[model samples]
Target: MHPYDTIVSRDVDAFPLGEFLDYPRLMSVDWREEEPRMLSAFFTATGLPADGTTLEMDDRTSYYQLVRGSDRVDVPWGDEVSAQHSMLVALQRVFGASHSIRYLNHGCADTASFVVETNEDWRRLESANPHVRWFFTPIERLPDVFKSDIDELVRVGETYGGA
Candidate 1:
């Protein structure tokens, strides 16, 4: 499976995900500051940081949003075909549970469009306000060791003179 699709199938913790994504455009162009801020407050209330995070809005609803920097992106909240709210179950029907998975965004049928993170627990937010409407690919950290290797290469090139 694609990394984003896999993350949506499951979930990862909220951390710095600014490096691995694009604008996730195609949302309603009419946006308000409160929408992103409200979601940010909801997440911080739930103990996540103010940025680079994606999680469900609440338990009852299927809405999920990504609050990265000052922006937000809504993941597919429904099958867009049925009344299903739980995207995992919805997507599983389209992509199957285990083997024989398929592609994400084709010209028309985007099977992976139904993916979402099923890991949120609303107990953390004291008020637990359901945002009702809003939307991931969980962005995995580039391995920590990779940075040190890059630094080492830079040092070696400076000393021995060849990259």
Candidate 2:
């Protein structure tokens, strides 16, 4: 049996996720700010300092973002859409493939809802532009050391990074 089955036994089907993350209340975002300020907010909220971490953001394209630390954390949140997308990917990794997921896009929904919507967006983007970049595979391919470590999961602005 799959390891995730024990954790996701209660779930019946896949749906988009809704705010499944348990970030600190201190997290906030300023969409109007420039990239640097946005970056600063991300690190501050996540309690990570600059020159202490290496980071990456994978969305339409894979790009490197600034962070402090030797290990890597992937941050994809900056806007609501990206946050949704990030949440979906996170759920898939955590809950296992058999679990149902969804994303309501607007109002409150269960964690599964969030995952579906985010994934739907990602799929739409990829379909429109096959060249569109995505970090899902790369991140999914990461070794277990990075995937399971909460300490390695760093947050930035509205994004998150993992070892």
Candidate 3:
């Protein structure tokens, strides 16, 4: 079945992995998606820090706070490193492995890719608000290596944040 055929609307509280991959609405997403906001949620899901401000990554569980005044990374389009790498691992686990993943920047604004990936709107949500920076691609082109690297990053990020 086509990747688009798999995604569907999902509850915001639940990790909509199964629904997203099963049925994608590509035309509607924001640029700076809700990534920063979801940091806590991601942490909570993996038995890490649930607080949004500080992060505990790696096995040692070092702590890192959300930097202030640091420019958020811009989301990437097809083939961009941001789209392929970054939070690939965590999302893969939340959603599943059969689906492909990628990120995209909003043409309307500049924002961190991290913020975008975690949002529900993904890409098109930004059009209305112009704040959406992150958007995930359909599950048609995910790479195996990308998924593995993401897993590693999560492990390390968790350690650094002290989750």
lDDT of 1 by residue, 1-163 (tens): 2223222211123311222223131111111222344333333323434444444354444455443444444434322322122222222232222211111111111111212222332122112322111112111111111122444423332332211
Supply the TM-score for candidate 3.
0.23
How far in Å is the alpha carbon of 117 misplaced in model 3? 11
TM-score of each: 0.18, 0.23, 0.23
Worst 10-residue lDDT window for candidate 2 reads 154-163
C-alpha lDDT of residue 127 in model 3: 42
| Cα lDDT listed for each candidate | 0.26, 0.31, 0.33
**What is the C-alpha local distance difference test score of candidate 1?**
0.26
List per-candidate RMSD values in Å. 20.1, 15.9, 15.8
lDDT of 3: 0.33
Candidate 3 weakest lDDT stretch, 10 residues: 105-114
Ranking by lDDT: 3, 2, 1
Q: For residues 44-143, what per-residue lDDT tens digits would candidate 3 score against the true structure?
A: 4334333333322333322222321332222222444333333333444444323223432212122222221333444344344321211233322333
Give the lDDT of residue 97 in candidate 3.
28
Clash counts per candidate, in order, are 4, 36, 45
